[model samples]
Target: MDPVIVVGAGPVGLTLSLALAAQGVPSVLLDEGPGTEEPRPARTVVLREDSADLMGRLGCRELDRVGLRWSGWRSIRRKQLVRNVPLSGGGGAEDDTALTGLLPAPLHVPQHELSAALRAAVDKAPLVQRVPLSRIDTLEQDPDGITVHTREPGSTWWRGSYLVGCDGARSTVRKLLDIRFPGRTAVERHAVAALRAELPWPDEAVLHRQPPWRTGGAEVSARPLPNGVWRLDWLLPPRGELVTPEALITRIRDTLAGWCGETPAYELLDTGVHTLHHRLARRWRKQRAFLAGDAAHLLGAVGTQGLDEGIRDAENLAWKLAHVWHHGPAEHLLDSYQAERRAAVAARLRAADQSLPILRGGGGLRTLVPGAARGHDTLLSDGHLGCGALGAPPSYSHSPLAPPHTEAHAAVGTPPGAPVADVTVTAPDGTTTRLRERLGQGHPLVVLVAPGTGVWDRRHWQTAGVMPRLTDAVAALPGSTELLVTESYPGASAHTVLLVRPDGHLVAAFGGVRPAELFTAARTALGGAPHEAREPVEPGDGESGGDGDGPDTGRGQGSRARVHADGSAGLH
Candidate 1:
């Protein structure tokens, strides 16, 4: 099989390549710039909890070591403390099923640091071929594969099964494909600066709002990065303001004085003026080429939504592409990439738009009305204020891959299309492990929860006439399908069967022992025919097989089943 072509070597592209490699899929990473260069002043990104989980899965733990973790944020108005919002309360509920405590806290790390860490992982991955300083001239896609032409000194070309554009806002791939990028750019610009200073409150981010009488009603945000570096952003005037270096320095010194009651010495590292944009491509996929990261959408820098969302785009798409490469063509599965990610990005943009007034120093109507402050406080407490700072990640309940919604499933808090809560479960061997740890192995996971206090053994499933059918069904699908019979699942009733995707999203949850329904749901979630038998190919195999055009005539790998002493069966 040919490698998947990944454009751009930024964090998003690097993540996509690493994810594909993790799934036993090969990829060619292309970037115009050499990967060795680091961005000056080092822009920081807020690595959300979900993205952090993805990084962990990709074996990129260096980021966590180099990032600062903060649990809450502070809001100040005119140097007066207004509110202290803990991110834990932003979108997390006080329930056992909540996903708050299962993952690492959000990390504040530099983008270059993230890229470097991912690049290091990529260097270790044998499946990825990194090509730097190769500017793409053009790309042509046929039904079988895509050919990318690069205009380096040697002018080389490469072939791949698919292409993904992780290039930034001025994405050459998106432009070459003629995809329209339509959205509004904010009239207000922000002057952002990075400095090395010791702040009093180094554990939490600070948002300061100045009244109109002081400094043109600017809003300043300060976030602590690793190594005592601070990222500061000052919302500049809407119009006619020159942000020269001297003026920006003066403004920074004045703001520091107000915060510390005196001007303190600090080293200015980098300064730049940025205009916010809320742009999305009309379509994310065109033929065999797809757009991701800033190439696909551009959100405001508020809450670092764009960066995290782009990483999600890579995660969501990589698994599908790998499935297709290993199995066969599932058009609906490939299409879900755009359907799910576009909807997620659009929802985030709407949330950001709704909170713009509050973030722009106006405080919205809360400042004018007597009782409106309560609503503002609720929004802040809920963590829906800007860019979904502490809000739960968007759901794919509307995606084609998601099972049809039902009230019974919703009542159990395991609705299809929602992320699977990371819960502790006991294996048949009496070993405890996180549910998330058993997933993301580039295959669908069918979790069979034993009813009541009785653990599910192979004898029990065989007596019920469900284990054989499920084992055969799972084995027939492409790739390795994991069938786990846990002793108990949180919030799940007795005898509940869950179909979880590789990315940890619930495909469907069956309340009772329904082998036929579970089989159909597994096939549907994997984008394979109910009875299709296709073999999973090893990466870099040069055999003739399905290029996602149609079904192949190869028989799938046989199941390797093992029965433990507890009579529990493990099938792969």
Candidate 2:
């Protein structure tokens, strides 16, 4: 088995490698790191709630330790408050209801800090072979694998079953594939700074939008970092404005002063200027090589979704590869990654288009006044500081992977393709636990047994009884796990069986059914091989079944590729 080759060492590449490693897949991580000490602006990235959950699931627990959690951003016009879009719906304070929910609140972290955490995870995982200072020279794909040629002091070649390009906006992989990235660019440049200062204002983040009345004004936003510094990004005047160090300093001071009555003395840590754009790749995949992160799309600063969306692309692609390798599922399974993620990013781009002008021009300042009407709602809906824009989880109802809702499984309100809400489940022994704690992770189809289903005794199944009929039904499929619990969520009926994919989305659910029939239905919904449904076994007559097999830990078992870290191919 060949390793999956990952290009680029940014957060997305590091994240993709680590996610695959956790699932027992190995990868070769290639990056041309610090070729030169070119100065770069201090940029901060915000992770939506779902993005935070993806990080937590991938074992990047250092985020909360090194990142600041903010409820939302305060939108202000000149010196007056226009509106406050609270992402969590509570005041600026941390909401306990949100903190205790399935996902954590949004986070603000310096780009470097986020990269460092992901790199640390990569360093710790043995399955991830990190080849720093290596750059991709060329790539060619054969029918079964891809050959990647890299250049450093000494050029070398490597092989992989799949190659994922997580390189930045000017992605070499995308260029090699000749996939056009089409979109509009903003001629205006933006200045971003990382600075430290003491302020007498609420800890929440703030975005100051200059009303259209101020023709030559720039929009500025500042957010607190866990490291005691603040990240400030403001639009710079068009090219001929003649920007100077003093002018930049004055701009920062003025922006800060407007938010916090007075600007105290401050130390500038870093600063840089760059242009932003709104672009998407014509295609994210070409044969065996694929694109993720900034390589796939660039939403620019208008929408702080570039990093989060890239992280999501990695999350969506990793599990499918794992499933294919581990279960020998149809290769078509891999196609869903593009189908689902591309649509999601398209929606995000549309939302960004509607809100970018509002952010830069304050086009909706009047509508944000107290008791404003719904006409301006789109302007404040899904931008950098908008409530609806955070994490914008996608619904794959139109995805081929989602089974259509049918009369057979109507009671479960969770429509096909919608993300499954984490529900608290009560055990027969009174032990309580959340579904997400077990549903996600491992690549497998989860069998959730709802309570009151006369199909089996709740206590008996919980303690450890197996229904032989259920075992025989899924025996042919590999890389699958099962869970038994009394229904705690409202949707589960007396006897319910929910077949969920490894990503935690419901594939199908059946109520008041027998084990064989439920298992057969689940297989069919999953598009697996056909299986004949059987009747429920008589008491003690069939093979006993407990929680189904745990995640596959053995090497080279699934249809997915197995990577070997032989170091036969070397890099600096």
- Output the number of the TM-score-best candidate: 1
**TM per prediction:** 0.83, 0.79
Off by over 4 Å in 2: 34-41, 85-104, 187-189, 211-218, 236-242, 357-378, 385-391, 411-414, 425-434, 445-478, 484-487, 490-496, 512-572
* lDDT per residue (tens digit) for residues 1-572 in model 1: 79999999998999999999988899999978877856755367777667877887788877756777665677776646778766552222232325453323467777777888898999999999999888898999899989999996638989999999998999999999999999877735788899988777766678776632344245687887767788888877666567888888877787777777677889899888877788989999998999999999988544535788898899899989988997778888899899999988888777766766765556555578874544454454334223233345768887777544443242346666877877665443435566777655677776665432233333333324234444554454434566655555667765566778988888888764344455556666776544452333222222122222111111111233333335354553
lDDT of 2 by residue, 407-456 (tens): 55645657666656566544223455555544345544444444433343
In angstroms, the error of model 1 at 160 is 0.8
Give the root-mean-square deviation of each candidate in angstroms.
8.8, 7.8
lDDT (0 to 1) per candidate? 0.70, 0.63
| Model 2's TM-score against the true structure | 0.79
What candidate 1 gets wrong by more than 4 Å, as runs, is 87-104, 211-213, 301-304, 357-366, 371-391, 405-410, 426-431, 450-479, 485-490, 528-572
Separate clash counts for every candidate: 0, 9
Clashing pairs in 1: none
